[model samples]
Target: MTKKFVTLDDFLGTHFIYTYDNGWEYEWYAKNDHTVDYRIHGGMVAGRWVKDQQADIVMLVPGVYKVTWTEPTGTDVALDFMPNDNKMHGTIFFPKWVEEHPEITVTFQNEHIDLMEESREKYETYPKLVVPEFASITYVGEAGQNNESVINEAPYDGMTDDIRAGRYFDDNYQRIRK
Candidate 1:
């Protein structure tokens, strides 16, 4: 069976692009000092690093779309969308549908939760998948404080320190506690 793909632009909906700054970093350190004479011996210093970042736009629909085929033997297919350029892409799962129906048509609409009273009525018959968003955190700490291995070991330890010191929740910790 031959598969066909389509883009989301063919459907009706709104496309939105969201972007945020991922941030920057820096590091510095000094090694051994001269013991014989009053002069400096082995020493090292490191610089900083930064990153540029952006996110792609996602398409949001308010209702459910319908996928129909003429042949009972035809296989069901999944739909895909592209918000960056406003396109809807999908592949036909069943070749029988093309052979029997000749021309197959699918409806793509916003998947609004309020349209149907019951959740089951809304998505009981279709496939539901959630795509999670990705985020990046740039590490910028004092020299010798930003070791990659240490940084990765207990990434959230810093947060615990803030919480334990009551800085995380207590807004006026500086004045109130002291």
Candidate 2:
């Protein structure tokens, strides 16, 4: 069989709730092919609307999309969304853990300030960090229907398709250096 990938233009919007095996749940919204918004209703960041996460989505198979992005907290995430089976899988690489155990996670830290400098000075680098946590996530439901996790907000208003005007930044715009 031939494998197909989702193109930017052919992309449809994505919104769903998924739960990790540990019972932490998140409501995610793929605002477009390039941006994501989510709310953590459980686990570490409950009740916060994490908006405008830059993401790259690739379709592994029909109804199965892989989304990858870096969070402002220095956390790297790769998630596979399988709506047909009502499941998702994820690997999260956290810099805080790497910061705590340098020997264990000796990999390139990308643009993350503290870890990036450490890796540069030590000359210990790899393309990507070896993720330690594998989260088995199951689809909870769609965005709105009886989901307490949904933040009930419209798509972030500050988003602009004009790349020349401004680069993609989080809702707080902290990533934008003055």
Candidate 3:
């Protein structure tokens, strides 16, 4: 039972832009970090949280075939083949508080974006094709939930990824210079 278009091999070990239904996008890649749970070798999925460009690796289980992340939040975030279609579809989750929705319809494509300050100059701005492709990963919000709460409630400590991303604000709640 093989699917059309992309397959397991084609989707893994490559770079793709993960687009969420709420218009949030991240540059994604993966590596098999040898951790096991329930016989599933954990896959470390690295996603750059584009707002300030911080990349963090999150553990996802049941990933050898269809990359699933359910252990972290007790909510299953899975990636599966889009039936009757050719692209990959699934629920993409970020580290702990970064993503709080049950899940968001995540679409992965061959689209790539280099967040390096120097690399951004290589291409001319094109019309965003990623915007229209985001469909709700959740059955509830067709557009998914807003990410502000997750960002706001996240702890502002030196250990947090958000702190490294320079997303902190002043005592008055104004964004400080990164």
Best by lDDT: 2
| Worst ten in a row by lDDT for model 3 | 34-43
Best-fitting candidate, scored by TM-score: 2
For model 1, state the Cα shift of residue 56 in Å. 22
Q: How well is each residue in 1-178 modelled by candidate 1, as lDDT tens digits?
A: 0112133222222211111122111111111110000110111101111111011222344322222222122233333333223233333343432233322212110122232223323223323222122212121111121122211111122443343344433342222232
| TM-score between candidate 3 and the true structure | 0.28
Could you tell me which residue pairs clash in candidate 2?
A: none
lDDT (Cα, tens digit) per residue for candidate 2, span 80-163: 865655567877665553345444222212224464445445553334454433344333222322222233342233222211
lDDT tens string, model 3, 1-178?
A: 1422233333333323333445443332332221111101112222212221122223223222344443322223455433223234555443332232212211111122322212223332233121123332111001112222222221222313332243543433334555
**Which ten residues in a row are the worst by lDDT in model 1?**
34-43
Measured on C-alpha atoms, candidate 2 has an lDDT of: 0.51
Off-target runs (Cα >4 Å) in candidate 1 are: 1-73, 101-178
Whole-model lDDT values for every prediction: 0.23, 0.51, 0.29
Ranking by lDDT: 2, 3, 1
Q: What are the TM-scores, per candidate, against the unseen true structure? A: 0.18, 0.53, 0.28
- Cα error, residue 172 of model 2, in Å, equals 27
